[model samples]
Target chain A: MSTPLPDPSSEQLPFEPRRPVADADRQRQSWNAIEARLQEAPVKKLPIAGWGRWWWAAAAVLLLLAAGAWWWQGRSGAGSATSYDLAYKTISTRFGEKRRILLPDSSVVILNSNSELKLPADWLLDTLRQVWLRGEAYFEISKSKQPGVDYFLVHTDRLDVKVLGTKFNVNAYTAQTTVALKEGRVELLYSQRPGRSAAGLRVHSMKPGDVVTVDEGPVLTPMLATAPPDVMADWTSNEYHFDYTSLAEIGRMIEQRYGYEMEFETAALADRTMSGHLRADNLDQLLQALQITLNIKIEKKDQLLKVSVP
Target chain B: MTTGAMPSPDLQNAWDRVLAGHADGLRQIHEALYASMIDYACRLLQDEMLAEDAIQDVFVKAWQLRAQIGEVQSVRAYFFIMLRRHVLNVLRSRQSRRRQQQQWQQQVELDPVFSAEDIRVQAEHTRQQQQKIATAVNELPARQREVIWLKYYAGMEYQQIAAVMEINYQSVVNLAFKATQYLRKRLSG
Candidate 1:
């Protein structure tokens, strides 16, 4: 009595119509068990190759800049950092650019976009391994150089993070400074200058996974390390994470990471937030991704960008 | 430029978080899609345990290589593709090992999860037609079964199937069309 099946071109499939309800429960249990095992595994970090040879040149440049700044401060950080800009170098990445430097002591540093690291010329000559950082950088410092146990010190504007040798990330933008220790040990020393005594520089030891933030004020005060280390998030890899973050903040990030000046018509629009993971090869690609996904409009005029809400 | 919006996981927020490599996202994706992937794997491997193993292997590899792989055009399809490769490799290795040991037995039978009985009810005549269509499909070759599942069960477009199968666009359409013609021939015969 049946003539024939409907034409397949219509995209009709007579496959199993009914799905078992009990299978859902079984699936949930299986997945839960797997998730538990995954949770027990150690956190994974990206593998960094050797880039130690070029650090001295970059550190030297940065040290010169730091010395110039220190001298301008009129002997404020006096007797602490002497002439070390000869072999030392300074390395920096402009907006949308990142650089990697290899320290004289063989420590590896990755300077984030719009970040700078300054090293003195006499870096290996002195007892202290010192560097000045602005913006963000991740360091894999070598603790020992065969015979001698080298001391490492990273001075941001507000605080100084010292470690013999360890892996950590430092974020020292204008707003605040944060240090996250991924491995080994680090000591945070707040630098109290101006009218405050040097004793104000309290030393706080940090363990792995420990993160501390130093706020910007007339005095440097350490905030409680409550929140997890979002500062240590890898931006260079594959994905960008934003959690209800404001458009203004996102714009600033894009500006830093892609060298784009993003503008909004209204302050409210600029403050609008979106949460998603964005993947793009470059700044233009990232902007296109955001626009395509968020149902927003973006127009680029020369070097300026105007993002409009739909 | 796979800008064409592909299907996202039901949990969009969780998917985005997974893309970001957050711990929460990892758990969410595992919970949300693991069962589906395992079921899909089971169709190929037949044994529930082996299917589960294959899926776990794929998921672990996916996680480890997530950063390097970058963003996926379609998360579901990507996972499915990974699972397919893993199961096939496992089958191949087992076959070779069995060959070396000379203990080879019968090939594993893929359970016929897709059947005419799954179609929605209609008139008596339509029901018969649906059953005939389902039977024809179940009888298709291994490659045809794959394209059928990807197109119908996974709801992947022709382009997606082509990309996942590593074939050209025309090849994908031709495969599907050929499968359809084969199904018609079987039903009519």
Candidate 2:
């Protein structure tokens, strides 16, 4: 068989016409198709009369006013609103205090110090199976056999975690959201809010042994770490363990944990790694041990703790 | 076609005619705009089924707010905007759902053959030679594509295209010129 040759003048070829689309005929077909599909789609009768119209108008007016206010405030400023429904629950723990929460679904949440989580009471609803958390939390999501219904979602400000009958730990505080999968597979979505529309929302997914962070914007860079089981659970049990945690990150963690301020003196020392386990109550002793082992001096002035090489 | 039946002109004039509290004017607006709105939505979403769904939503929403819709400057633009918003909402929710199940690595690789640049280049050449110029029209740069769609498909003016695309009049002129030039080159070649 002879191969069909490419047309050399294909680029020069004028537009080709097959048949005209009769708008009237196509419209009739489209109307029929729309009717059939509408029958299948869930239709929520939005009553425009009575209180509903007023409510909607009020909402629209409020939104317009808010938009006007936002423009006046500064068009480019970050604006966020937090709304919670009746089916959701929010738990916040102060610094140095750990809290345990049992969700409306069978999932268990162990919120570490200075952490908070908002989760829906029922995961069976098609629209409301998601959860949002800040700081750190260990989740043991209950398993469900319903094919597509079994999903546990955790949303931080920047990261979104999706799990199907798995255990994972998410440490997503102010700047970063990190996920460590201990069992099964967990999907992590790192979203960067693009400054420009062309960039859109940059998203990345992560799997087991993958720790992904969604920082302030839409860049998702992953770091590899051993999938240690129940590392987050230890925090709730008054134990903190770090396997090669960086000095800078450790310093930040210390600040968050104790509600004290800490800073590294030099950039080189910030990269220094530490590995140890210490009771949550013995942070002072742990800091002393770190100073001795790392050959550094720890200075305290009011609320600030400074670490420096002597 | 009965003589006693309400004349099309009378029916058209019966904007205030309320049939069981439903405005006849609104019904006529939906009837006039529904098909075009669906076509526009389908082009934006590139999904026939989704476009149909969005049109249904638009009709429901229009019916519910029939009173307020009278204030709309252009019913066509209003309906198209509604459909556009609905399609974007659907796309965003779908993206969120897809992000949950799919691996990040698998999803990041841009489709080699169907990249935006390739489509734009191919469209530029093919659009010039076509009799039915609309299909090739969608291949232009987003601004030009939108301008042509509004100008030819919707029978809108340059000023209207400027308003719809949220661009200045000069920019619209430049885009249309550039688009026409590409078409001319392809046709003359």
Candidate 3:
């Protein structure tokens, strides 16, 4: 532990990773590209007086964003499979943060807090519209007018949901993958167990309001039912809507959203379930609601939250 | 190549100009930090073109978000932090693909013949010593390499490095110490 520190200043560290040389032409070309883009979007200067003028700029920016989205998606048709392999893009949200991402084909994905969605960098430009999800996301896929390439695929650890331009919410935070269909139809494809052959892959078709939760068992058991209107896609509106969700599952959601570690005073406390909604904007408020509704006491210390029966 | 231990006055001035809605300020900031930023980005993303594109996006985003950006302690750290987050997003997207490539690389490194070739190529003294240092630095884990680069090449203090890496000051100090210890052992033994 008493080893003297090595002085880095006295020694020459010859580990330079390709320092860019001052090439005049290259510099000019790079600067010009930046300059041209800057010209398209000017800095917002006036806070109040610029409101009227700002709306015009806002409209222009939206148009440019739409066009850029189209360009990225349109250019993907010519790229080879190798290019797609090298062109994966991941969009994620930090604790207590949510983001809305518009895919190449104009499919909208509202990623939940502490969630990640990985897809081809060019959006839906891949021959097969495919994406991988971890955590949770609400997807409103735009139906492709074209027949052969209309289906979209969402892969999780437990199952894959093949979509035909439907609105759905996917929660894959745990080993169990839950797909709640809000509108249209989706086909759930997964094997009963790992290392199963292609013939073992099971496909379960879903209709609107269908909620199928595939358990993380050696033999995966899928429980199919219908979720109430408010239970699904509620997080998208900044609310935690639970339909008799167990306290353990609620604790996991809290852990994911607020980066807190939850511990139960007794294992039995985790089994108690709660239903209905709580505003997700503030942590303390949500916890207070839990206390009032569930009659359990939660004590928070630093990064840990402990729940006990009152 | 050195931009002083203190925050560069030119960068601060350029940032002020950028806040005031002047394109020339951005140009000055770009010209000053472009080389170092691009080098850092290239290390994070092993693709040259992607690094260049990422740098360009950083500058463009900086200009766009100028109005909302609050006062920053150091301009260099701010730009580095911004670029770091941008590259991390890109890296996360390519995680599965890159993991496979890294597994293949580990298999190659495990081959005895590859180590023999490395030993035979170390015949020359001075040049080999330099190469050995480079290889040692490169062989360090990703976080260690990042710490070493930010400290030595970027000439940043531990506090600034912590801010750029979004870690605590103690964690940065520990990482820097751990990295130096590894490098010393590799170079001496």
Candidate 4:
């Protein structure tokens, strides 16, 4: 007789309680250190000491210097029509339209459809070039001959893009803020307002071919990695290309694109992440591709598709 | 379902101590509740690290927002709900990354031999039988798999599972029964 085959249930299972590893203790220590640092850091308080007065004076002097530097930089350029309060004026564009704005400091901005730009009425000659944007725009900043006075800045709802002399496109929609550096160098700050509190803004400098998305919160931090250049500008070309997108987010996108409701049968299945792109016109074709590619099943009842594991 | 209300006084005292920033009191609460929290997170994410991280973040956030942490209807339930939201956020974020074509997938797939009923079986014979049962369980439909996990792993009552899953309790019971029957057939085959 042949030897009896081992039952699958009779095999030694890998279920065992994991003991606390040495790394866990190290993690605990690191957490404690961080807590301690937070506790020790300066807390917000009313300043009352003589040294506090000195600190206030020092702060005032620094502010004046910064303002003076800004004014000086704004005035350094010649042959350009300069307005004292150019930034206070607001410029906007409607859908299916583009507007070219010539700032007094000689910086050029090409605003795309459904875009808005708000700048100061009088752009101080010696100060930083700053402007607010709501939609997509391409910036071509002119270089200043004077040192320390040539930096150009674009402010979005969540980020500040600074350029010395470069071309960049910023798509700062409320849902997603993206900065793509086409050439030269650009510095992205994490605020509409800069040079207030250091903690108020997080900054990142980008080189050409770099694209950053501010996805997490109000404070715009650059994404850890740049997306592929081909798919990064897909929105402009009406081509939707997602490298790896979750089903839940895809559900949201589907809702936005076709105005349909989609839900997952299980949270686990909802949590299932899929990566693919479809050029189809409707939801059924996209779901068909998704189902075949990801080994997922979609049950369509009326308008909703309940996505689940096959 | 049992309301399962514990003495509210101990929870209130614990809350006071936590509000006072006593580390030991916080640790005591953690010790009292960590198992259930970890289990809920594990059921949600199917990853131990992610579950642990969720628990740790819940504790840190609770401490940070101690002022806002209102009176305990049930501290355990409150803590579980909070941790569940955190786990959901993690899941949502992981899903977003997955949408972007990222390769990191948290392993949540259960072994095939561990049936929902087998989880309740404490005997050595059933422990030996777990592998076959788990395999059979894995072969069940997606809805059946979820029903099994919610019942056994999270220890949620049928009604509680219904509420959390947004499904009828009858459907949950039917799914569980079907899942068990499928496992039995697969094992016998």
Candidate 5:
């Protein structure tokens, strides 16, 4: 295969003919193919009568004025109206809440607390099954038997999880996004910056029992041997297991699950580690268990939970 | 055919005629963009007949919506955008219908030869084959391939490419740069 560096000055491509010449036969065939459809729908013409033309012209003038003003506004707003933000429908869960959503394609998403999922509003019309995720979510994506429609994409701020009908848990609430696949296959695509161009993008395929965490930089750690996939997804069963996890990390999880402002007496206390299982479903039970396990005093003033060594 | 670096005055005049409800004007626009549009759709859909159908749909829809299309900055960009959207929607619906039919067949007939696993593997194979462009360009991701196509082959600026691809302009610029760098390195190596 011949690969020539593309020349900006030239109009032709290196790999294939940039534009195949439209020979007479092909052009005629194309014209004949579309001529019938084109004729079926001619441009609708407004009826021009004596007084109606004047009214129509006045209405057209007003319409043009409004359109011009809108055009100016759109230009000033940097084309926000035409941007992709309007194309999505967002579903969010509040703190201490979990919601189950059924996508248009019959896929199931179990949204964890304080997470948001932005699904394309026009899913049926779109060629891509793409959804934006903020925070953690467990997904059981329905597999597509068709060729072009099989790819499902889950986009986070740090990574994109591409899968073909896989069961996986994604935690994107923090700076680092972790993806643990329970069943089927998944491909993690990420760049140094989320939604960056394909240049910095990296793709890593994950099979069942695979766990990968992606940070803001080039730190991608695949911890399949260290962490069990079942432990990763056990949160769905209301089980919290920590193996030598730092108190700072546990504080973040408590904040997300209960909407509390966590405070430690000192930096050392925040860095203190714990290893145990806390199966409490509610905040009080979890806090009681924490106090009993760590020999610490907990003071709750409204929504703030402060920890201090007694 | 022009590479569409600049929107031609001829296309602008043809678009004006189209807005004025002239079928011949629409014919002119169609004839001018036929080859490039077909090539683009064929590359994306990989089926000439479907590509032709998609082009026909674009023209018919363009004529139908001419009154509402108003004055676009570039008639070439408008048509390409319309063609791209129509082709994707067609592929999505066609594939969706095929999927429903497959599920129905599974429930009713349960053919051992055409099992669900066979179809899944075949679908996976087709996806791999789609990525096999048989050139250094094949190494680029799907989105990068689009950026390369629009920048090099379609002769579109970053802004126009961004509009058609529904991404931001900066992304298109970065993608083009990344793709060019990759292609140059691969070719040189």
Candidate 6:
């Protein structure tokens, strides 16, 4: 850190990046933009591009943005695939944030907070729809009876949920993969890809209301048959339903949804269990509800939210 | 190879006028430094529009704090410092945008830092020797790229570069030394 730059800099032949001449017209426009900006309130810094052309620029920018988006994907390698030229689309949400996306086939996917769903850039994998998911999501499949349209597949690290005209929930996080079918049928394929697992590893068929959670191995089990709507899929409505769940658990959900760090004033507060549904639209609303329900005082300091008995 | 640090009487008057917040002062200074600043920024950010935007932001910041800014020593280097900060900010925002939209999985080493090879790949200068220099420069890290550009391209002295880069003078010298060693090793060996 203390070394001095040598006299010749690098190699006695210091390199410079290529330089392009600036356009005089753009300089004049930028000057005008700055001058006009000076006349306005001194609070706002002027935009680099002239603000006069913003609205029209917005539409033009959208077209440019699409191309920019493609370049960005390639630059970042988010697609993480060997194939190039496919405009891969990724949808991710923070904790407490849920996003609904309609696929090209009209299938609906509602991603829960702290989750991601990625669709391949093109329909290149034959007629089947394939998606990669991390965290949790609720999917309502649109029955595509058209010939050549295969079933939809949602892939996780350990398992793949294959659906066709089925409504299902997939919770795939580290060390656990849970798939709960609401209606219709689905197939849970474990390490189903060729060369991944033993040849005998079979695809498990799932019936409606069937909940299968697998860890190191595929374990099929049924969740509550009449699991309350909130516990099952209340996230779709932007409401989280917790039944006798600990305050610590609720705090974790809020942290995941809103990216707020939750700190309890007393250890006992974390152990207190409550059951109810809280809105996920805003942090303030959820905090207010918590304050009223738990009889606790909540203090928010930037990214940290503190819970204490009032 | 002039550092643009040798302040002429005209440039001094421009500096005084900018301090006084005169319209002509701002115009004169902008005309004097606009193109060169853009070129310097283009080295940091390959996108021409982004480079332009960084310089425009620099002008805006300059105007915003014009009254408080007193007589300056090297107006060009001072503005160069400001432009470098803004370009870094733009690069950061672009990186975050990429992360948000595409979910950056791998660490992408943008070795060139908008070097000429990245911007003007087809400038009819792809001869063997030029190609070798380009390849060697492109292999350097972004920090080395900036230091190399500030030293040789912008013609900034070590002290001025340290001021512009907000690093200690010795640190700048050491960085330049390391960059030189790397280039020498690569270009010769």
Ranking 3 against 6 by TM-score, winner: 3
**What docking grade does candidate 2 earn?**
incorrect
Model 5's CAPRI class is: incorrect
- Model 5: per-residue Cα lDDT over B41-150, one tens digit each: 76676544456667877888888888899888878779889988877776665565446456433221100011111112134446343233235576677788777776
What TM-score would each prediction reach against the true structure? 0.43, 0.41, 0.48, 0.33, 0.46, 0.42
Output the better candidate (4/6) by TM-score.
6
Clashing pairs in 6: A3-B174, A4-B173, A4-B174, A5-B172, A5-B173, A5-B174, A10-B180, A95-A256, A95-A257, A96-A257
Per-model i-RMS? 18.9, 11.7, 9.4, 16.1, 10.9, 9.5
lDDT of 4 by residue, A25-75 (tens): 334432453344333433356554558546645644454444323422322
Q: After superposition, how far is residue A208 of candidate 6 from its true place, in Å?
A: 2.9
Q: Least lDDT summed over 10 consecutive residues: which range in candidate 1 chain A?
A: A75-84
Model 2, A1-310: lDDT tens per residue? Answer: 3122233334221111111212554455445544444334445767634796466445444433432222122112111111123344345555655655555355677777666665542223223356677678888888753356677677665556778877778887666666777677777655343422334444445555555544554555555555556554466555667889888888788777667677778888899987877653445555666777789877766667777897
Residue range A43-98, candidate 5, lDDT tens digits: 57465457854764564444334422221231122110111232445566667666
| After superposition, candidate 6 runs with Cα above 4 Å error | A1-87, A94-96, A124-126, A191-196, A199-202, A215-231, B1-189
TM-score of chain B, candidates 1 onward in order? 0.76, 0.65, 0.80, 0.60, 0.78, 0.78
lDDT of 6 by residue, A1-310 (tens): 2222232223221112232345565567667756666665456644534673364345444433453233223223222111222244565665545566656566778777677776654432223567777778899988864446558878776677888798888877444667888888899876543433656466788777677777544443323334533266665665667779898977866665567788999999999888866754455666767777889887877677877897
RMSD of every prediction:
23.1, 24.6, 23.7, 23.8, 25.1, 25.1
Shift in Å, residue B63, candidate 2 = 44
Q: Can you tell me which runs of candidate 2 are displaced by over 4 Å?
A: A1-88, A121-127, A145-148, A190-207, A215-218, A221-234, A264-272, A277-282, A308-310, B1-189
Which of the predicted structures, 2 or 5, would earn the higher DockQ when compared with the native?
Answer: 5
Q: How far off is residue B33 in model 6, in Å?
A: 31
- Tens-place lDDT digits, model 4, residues B84-128: 667767766555534444434564332222333334444564654
